[model samples]
Target: MAPAQAQMGTIFLLFIGISKAINDVQMLKPIDLSIEVLILGEVLLSWKPNVNPELESYVVKYNVLIKTPMKEEQYTTQNNSTKRMVALHKGLCAQVCAVYYEREKETARSQWAKAKLQAPPGANGTSITNLSCVIYTEASNNTAMDCSWLPGEEAPEDTQYFLFYRYNIHLEECQNYSRSHDGKRHSSCQFAKTDIQITEDTIVVIYVNGSSKHSTIKPFDQLFNPSTIERINPPMNITVALKQESLCAEWMKPVSVWPSPCFTYEINVSDWVTGSTKQLTVKDNSICLLTNSQSRYSVQVRAAGSDLCGNSKQWSAWSKPVFSDKPQKASVLLLLFLVYGALAGIMLLSAVLCTRFQLHRRLFPQVPAPRNPFKDLLSYNEAPTEGALEVISDIDDPEPNE
Candidate 1:
C-alpha cells in the first residue's frame, strides 16, 4: 500500500508541472494590440511583445490572420515588428498571434489579437457607369435634385457603393439616400436645396465608386452646370397679339423650374418682312410692346433663374415662335376717302335737284283767266268781251226772273 501511494503522489506532481507549462504558454499572448488604416485599403497592425521574460526570449515571429466577409488572409512578420496587410476592405477583423520556435523544431502560436479594420478614405474603384442627374421640382415648387447610377462592372454582390460631389472648392458626400423597393440601400441620392451652390459661375461635379473585399475601382467623376440641367423645359403655350401699334407676346413659365418668381425671361422678336431681330429681357412672362410694328413680327421666349434665387446664368431652350401682323394704314385711308366721296356726291345731288326745281317754275309761268265756273260759262256763250258783270240763275225755276 505504501508503494502504490508513492507512485500516485509522483503522478500528481507531474500533472501539476504540465498545468504550469500550459499556463505559461497561454500567458504568452501579445499585449497592446491595435490597428490603423494607413492608405489605400491597407491596414497597419501593431502590438507589443509579451512581458514574460522566458516567453519573450522564445518568440520568433508574429502570424496575422485578416478575416473579411469575403475571404481571409494570412501574413507573417518579424518579432516585435508592425505588420501591414494590403488589399483589405472595410468590416475587417484582425487576429494576430505570437509564433515561438520550440527547440528549433516547430512553431507554436499564441492567443489571437482581434480587431476590425478601418475604412480607407474615399471610395475606391473605376468610374461608375450611366450616371444621371436632374432637378426635381415638384408641383409645390420644391428645389431638389436627384442622382442615380449603375454599379461598376463585375461588381460583386457583397460590394458597397458611395456617392460624393464637388462644387467650386467644396467637396462633400451625399447623405440623403433613397432606398430600393425591398428597403435595401440603393445607388441613388437626393440633394436638397441647401446643398446647392448658386453662384454666377457655379460648377458642380459628382463621383461614384464601389469597393469589395479584394478590389477597388478608380472613382468615376463628372462635372455639370446646374443651370444647364435645371429649368431646361422650354417655355410653353406662347400667344402673340397686336396691341395698338406694337406687337404683344405672352407665355407661360416653364414647368421644370420651381417658384415662378425666381425666373427671368428673354423675349426674342424678329420681323418676317425686314428679317431684323430684337431681344428683350423681362422679369415677367409677357412683353407689353415690341417695336417695328410696320412689318409682320415673330416672338420666342426662354427662361432662366434670377440672381435672387437660383442665379442660373444659362438660358433654357426657346419656345416655339409665335407670329402676329400689324394693321395697315392704307386700308384706313381708303375707307376715309370712300366715306368723304359719298357725302360729297349726296350734297351735290341735293343742290342740283333744288336748282332744277327753281328753274322749271321760272321757265313756265301759270296764268289765271276766270274766277268762277258760271263766269266761265257766260264767257263761252257770250262773245269775246274784255270785261262784263254777268249773273246766272238756276236753269229750270228762275229763268223767267233772270
Candidate 2:
C-alpha cells in the first residue's frame, strides 16, 4: 500500500510541470511585426497583420512619448476595437502596440514600436486665404505697355507655375487676375515692355508662388498718350481735273499708318508749263482741293507731326495733265469739199463714154455686102460691056495671009 501511494504522488508532480511548460510556450511565441508612419502637421500611424495565416481581428494601442534633452512627455491612448490599426496624434512622440487574434485562438501581442513627431523645419502655420491683383489696364488706345511681378528667392524646378497676365475690358482691373493652384514646382518671373494700343482705363497684374495657391495682385497705370506712327505703305492716291480757270486736284490718305493718331495733311502743287508752285495745308482729313487752273500741273501730299516716329508719309502718285478746249478753223472744210468735187467729175465722164459705145454696137449688127468687082476693075470713062474677042480674031487672020 505504501509503494502504490508513493507512485501516485510522483505522477501528479510530473503532470503539473508539463502543464506549466505548455502555458509558458504559448506566452513566449514570436510574433511578426509591421509598422507605418506619416508626417503632416501631425504624425499618422498605421499597422498591418503581423501573423502568418492572418488574424481575424486586432486590438491597437497608440501613444506619443518624447524624451527631449530638456524634458519628456507621454501621450498614450487605448483603441480597443477589433479592426485594422490606424491612429493620429499631434504630439512630439508616438508609440503603437497591436494584439492579433484568430477565430479559434488568441495570438501573441506584437512588440511596441516608437516614433518621434515634430513640425517641419519651415512651417508657417498660416494658410494663404486669397490671392488677387490690385491695379490693371483695360483701355483701347493705351495698352498695358509694360508689366512685371515680385521676384522669388530661388528658381523653380518647373517654370509652368510662374506669374502670368490677364487683360479684361469689361470688369474692374482687380477682378481680372487669376493664379495657379496646383502643387507644382515654383519659379520667378520678369516683365517686358510691349507695343499695343489699349483704349480702356484698368489693367491687372497677377503674382503666383510655387504651390499655385499662394498668389497676389497689383494695378497698372492707364496710358492715354498719343500713338507713334511708324511708316506708310504704297503711298497715297492723287488725281487732277481741269475746270474753266483753275486745276482741281484730290488725294487719298496713306494706307500704311501704324499707331494711328490725329493728323494734319498738306499738298504741294506745281505747274509744269508756268514753273510756279503753291502750298495748301488741311486739317485731320486725308482729302485736299487745289484751285490753280493751268494746262499742266503736278501735286503731292505729306503728313507730318511730333507724334510720328519716322519721316512724313511720302507724296501721292502725280496728277495727270489738265488742258482746256480751243476753237478750230473752217479752212480744212473748204479743202475737203474741192477734192470730193474733182473725184465726182472724172467718174461722170467715164460713165457717159461707155453708154455711147453700147448704143452704136446695137444699131449696126449686120455685116456689109461685098463691093461690085467689075465696076472697080474698069476706068472711070470705060463702058461696062465691051467685047474684045472680035478685034483679036481679025488681027491674027491678017498675019497668017502675009
Candidate 3:
C-alpha cells in the first residue's frame, strides 16, 4: 500500500509540473495598448494585463519597443506596471508585450500590441517652430528681467504659455509677467529679481512651452546670453533745460539686463514747427545743443547695447517725449534791437532839451527895461530946463486933452 501511494503522489506532482509548463508556453499577450505625448518630450504608455490567471503567474515583466523617425530602442521593466513613461518625438510608435521567464531566460512573449503616439486633447497639435526669446530690462524695476516670444503657427487661439530658464547651476520657472493695458495675458515672463548671481561664465538658456484646448504638449528650447537677445530699455527721466543760451538734455541710463555701462544712447531733437530733426549718438547720457532756433521742440531718448556686450546693432523704442520752449533767434535779436532803439531815443531827447535850454540862457539874459513918459515929463518940469520943460509940458497937455 505504501509503494502504491508514493507512486500516485509522484504522478500528481508530474501532472502539476506539466500543467505549469503548458501555461508558460501559452502566456497571453497584453492588449489595448495606448500612448500619450507629454511635455518635456516624454510619452506615457499603458496596456491591459493578460486575463489568464495561470499565464499571469509566469509573467515577470513587460517589454516595450519604441520606434521614432531617427531610431528604435527596447525597454524592459521588471515591475508589472500597466504604464510607463519614455522619451517621445514626432511619428513615434510603441509595442508592448507580456514577458514570461523560466530559469532566468525569456520563455515566452505575447504578440506585440501596437499603439500610435498622439498628442493630448486641448494641446497644440504640432511642435513649436521658430522659437525665440527677446530679453529686456525695465527701468522702472531694476531687479528683474522679462523674456517674451510670439506664438508659433497653428497655435490655438486660447493657448496659454509658460517659460522656464536655466543659468549655470540654477534652474527655475518664470513666475511673474507684464500684462497688457486691459489686464489681458501677454507673451512674456519675468525672472528672479533678487538673491541671484550672474557672471561671464554663466550661460542662460530659456524654454517656452504652451498648451491649449486643442494643441499638442511640447516645449521649445533656446540657448542664449543676455547680450544675444538683449533689448536695452529706453532712457529714463528725459529732461530738457535751458543752459547757457542753449538747450541741454540730460537723461538717466536705462536699467538693463546687462550693466548700465554697456549701453549706448541716441538723442532725437525735433522742431515741430520748423519740421526739422537732429539725431546724435553718445556713450554718455547727456547732450548739449549749441543753439536751436525753434520755439517748440521735442526730445526723445533711445538706447542699444554696446559692442562690448555683444549687442550693438539694434536700438530700443523711443522714450516718452520731453518738450522744451525757447525763443527763436530772429525774435530775440529783434527784441534786443527794439530795446536799444528806445534807449537811444530817450537819450537824444534829453540832449536836445539841454542844448535848447543853454541857447535860451545865453541869448536872452539881462534885457533892459523901458522908461515911463509921464515920469520923464514930471522930472523935466521940476528941473526947469527951458527947451526940455517946454517939450514935456506940450506932450503932457496933448495927452491930457486926448
The most accurate candidate by TM-score is: 3
Residue 231 in model 1: shift from native, Å? 3.5
What are the RMSDs of all candidates, in order?
Answer: 23.0, 33.8, 18.5
Candidate 2 has a TM-score of 0.22
Off by over 4 Å in 1: 1-125, 128-132, 136-207, 210-216, 220-229, 290-294, 325-402
CA-lDDT, candidates in order: 0.67, 0.39, 0.67
Instruction: List, residue by residue over 1-402, the lDDT tens digit for candidate 2.
Output: 999999999989976775454335422222232223331111234433233333323333333334433345555445321121121122244445544443433344445655554422211322121232221122232223222233233323233233444333222222232233453432222222233332223223232323323432111112122222122222245555555555555555444323335344666666665787777777443433444432356666665432334333333333343332210122345557778988998888867876868754676577899999787667555644665333324444455654
At residue 35, what lDDT does model 3 achieve?
73
The clash numbers for all candidates, in the given order, read 5, 32, 10
> In candidate 3, which residue pairs get closer than 3 Å at backbone N, Cα or C atoms, i.e. clash?
122-212, 122-213, 122-214, 122-215, 123-215, 123-216, 124-215, 124-216, 125-215, 125-216
Candidate 2 structure lDDT: 0.39
Candidate 1's residue-wise lDDT over 1-402, tens digit each?
A: 999999999999986785576466655667777777654334578788774565655636778887766567887887555544343434567877877665663345677877776543444443356878865354555557788877655655556668877654556778887765555436789877535643335556776666667565545555566765564456778988887676778788777545578788998888776788988899988777745555677788988777777545568878888877443453456679999999999999977986878855666667777678876776676655668655667666555754
Models 1 onward score TM values of 0.35, 0.22, 0.44
In model 3, state the lDDT of residue 189: 70
For candidate 3, lDDT tens digit of each residue in 75-159? 8986434343333434578888877775586766777888887533333443455545555544545445566666655676666
